[model samples]
Target: MKKQYIFAVVVICLTLTAFLLTDSSDTIVKYPTGYRNWTHVKTLVLEKGHPLYEAFGGIHHIYANKIALEAYKSNKKFKDGSVIVFDLLEAVNSDNAIAEGSRKVVGVMEKDSKKFKDTGGWGFEGFNGDTKERIVKNMYGECFSCHLSQKNNDYVFSQYRK
Candidate 1:
């Protein structure tokens, strides 16, 4: 009986160790808490006729932290730790008027020159809907590929306007 109990404990430990070792990623982007209060950079609605209306068509709002906002205003390279959030929400059209609907995803671009050097010094992530569930598996392939087109703008698509 004691031998069986010891074996069970060993098995549990090994299982836990394996699980820890097999976690998705240690460098996963953290959910941006209090991002709503950040500086509002812009709002764009990608209607059905828009060029990028398939994958990202929605009521997208951009928010930038202080560091990111400074870069936007200065037109300089984004400093490390500058975080920009893209809040993607459904566009509910009622009575020929459009309203903000449920959230689709909260996309984020966090600048870290050393950490994300391969991805043009930015880390990309997407939080599924309103929850903090991470959806980005391949930051370089899934995200950076599309963003590469905006290489001149520091791999950022949206431009800051007054």
Candidate 2:
């Protein structure tokens, strides 16, 4: 009887351990909803022959939620619940003028201080253009690494243009 009880306790502990591990991994960021209707921050074009042309050659539209916008405008760190979106679209030439084309990707950065403590309180994600499938499974190596260089600016690269 004692052996059986011990075995049961061991099983319970193992189950709890497994549950916690799975839950942490499942904390992968979710796509922010209704980000499209957020405030338009800026627009940029990465022209061909530019250094980042191959990776980000497109017409990029940046948006930010109210919280993020406030933080940007005030030059403060982005607060928790802040969200920013980078909408990338193809740039096509029509009548010798560049125009926006189909979307290429939708990149996002969500601020949750505790949940994303490993990445400067930011959760990064990239959604594919067509089906909105998430492409960036992790941000530590890819997104956060790049943004780390901008630590002086609160890990944000974009500035609010007056």
Candidate 3:
């Protein structure tokens, strides 16, 4: 009977170890401070019927002190300016590989006259070393749709349209 109990404990320990090892690789850490050459862009002016009127678009209403930080990295550059807007959410679960509610999304916008640009464009999905996988997807459908109309105005639709 004692041998059987020992065997079960060993098996459980091994299984847990395997799960922990496999889950760690999926975690990623992100921070806004990593971006270099930071600057403050003009606060956005949101008009009715704007495509970004949905929840994921974030809170609307225009004021100079809306608190958006913009910047370009040293090594990376574009003809106009590779604009990036980022927001850091409060961390939730710090210990687990899969943290719930600890993450951020960074939007990258590049100016283009001919092509429809990302108005609040491509998002860089980030997570802080958790089992939840960090994903960065191109928001071509959501962000690009609005910028297409702003072709005459440098493909940005918000108040800070280039």
Best by lDDT: 1
- Which candidate number would show the highest TM-score if scored against the true structure? 2
**Local distance difference test scores for all models:** 0.90, 0.88, 0.40
Candidate 3: segments with Cα more than 4 A from true spot? 1-37, 44-53, 57-81, 86-104, 111-138, 159-162
Q: Clashing residue pairs in candidate 1, if any?
A: none
Clashes of each: 0, 0, 5
TM-score of each: 0.82, 0.83, 0.35
- Candidate 3 residue pairs in backbone clash: 97-130, 97-131, 98-130, 98-131, 98-132
Give lDDT tens digits, candidate 1, residues 4-112.
9999999999999999976756456768899999999999999998887887898999999999999999888899989999999999999999999999999999998
lDDT of 1: 0.90
TM-score of decoy 1 = 0.82
Candidate 2 stretches greater than 4 Å from native = 1-26
